[model samples]
Target: MSFAADSPFKSISILYRKSHIWLNEGCIPCDLTAAQAIVIMIVCDFSTLTQDEITKRLSLDKSVIAKTVTKLEERGFLQRTTNPKDKRTYDIHPTEKAWQVYPHIREQVEACFCRMTQTMSEEDRQNFRRLLDTAARAALNQEE
Candidate 1:
């Protein structure tokens, strides 16, 4: 499946695949895959997001989040507590173990972005971010 060199959608898809591979490699020593590390980071950063919220934020399937959260919990990197207002839902939290390694995780994330955009000027980087945000929101809004 060849896409035109000038196609933005093709570029975005290629970027996502490359980014996933990069993250997976970087996360290997952390005893996590790229997706698991991403989930842990999200929980650590939010500190109070529900499973449903995580699914929406990552645009992943609920079952995938459930499995990832379960694995993290088993690894002592995360804790899930039932939401007081909704017994069926659970709020995810990063454990002390997760906090201890968060700096490394953060650095890995930053390094990936830096490497990806190393060739771009500051202005271009900012514009790229703005455009991505706009496109992402527009895509999500259209789904509603």
Candidate 2:
């Protein structure tokens, strides 16, 4: 299909949709949606983070982060403890369950990205990543 020469939106949207599907499918064995897997990975990486911190990191709404955290907590993958310095806020920590599944999640994420860039040479892959980062920053109106 021929796309308009001036626009990258169509290609970007298609890539986003396809990548989302691939990631979602890849996460099924872990019993996680892509969003849940991402959240777990972030919390695991950070060790402990507040809902607001997660919200900012992922650029997602506070309510979405709260709900995802609550679900993870209920599923035994995370624990929420009252922050020592902040009585009103809770710090999120990964539980044993999350630790157990961490490797699988990481593998799936790695596999997905590898598949996405499989046809590209190392140099091309690096360039693609740099370009994507530049585009993302521009879209977010951030200084490069």
lDDT tens digits by residue: candidate 2, 43-108? 999989988889877777888998999999999999999999999999999999999888888888
List, residue by residue over 25-75, the lDDT tens digit for candidate 1: 888788778898889888888988998888888888889999999998999
Off by over 4 Å in 1: 1-6
Q: TM-score for each prediction?
A: 0.90, 0.86
All candidates: CA RMSD (Å): 2.3, 2.5
Clashing pairs in 1: none
Measured by lDDT, the strongest candidate is 2
Model 2: runs farther than 4 Å from truth? 1-6, 134-144
Most TM-score-accurate candidate: 1
> Which pairs, if any, clash in model 2?
none
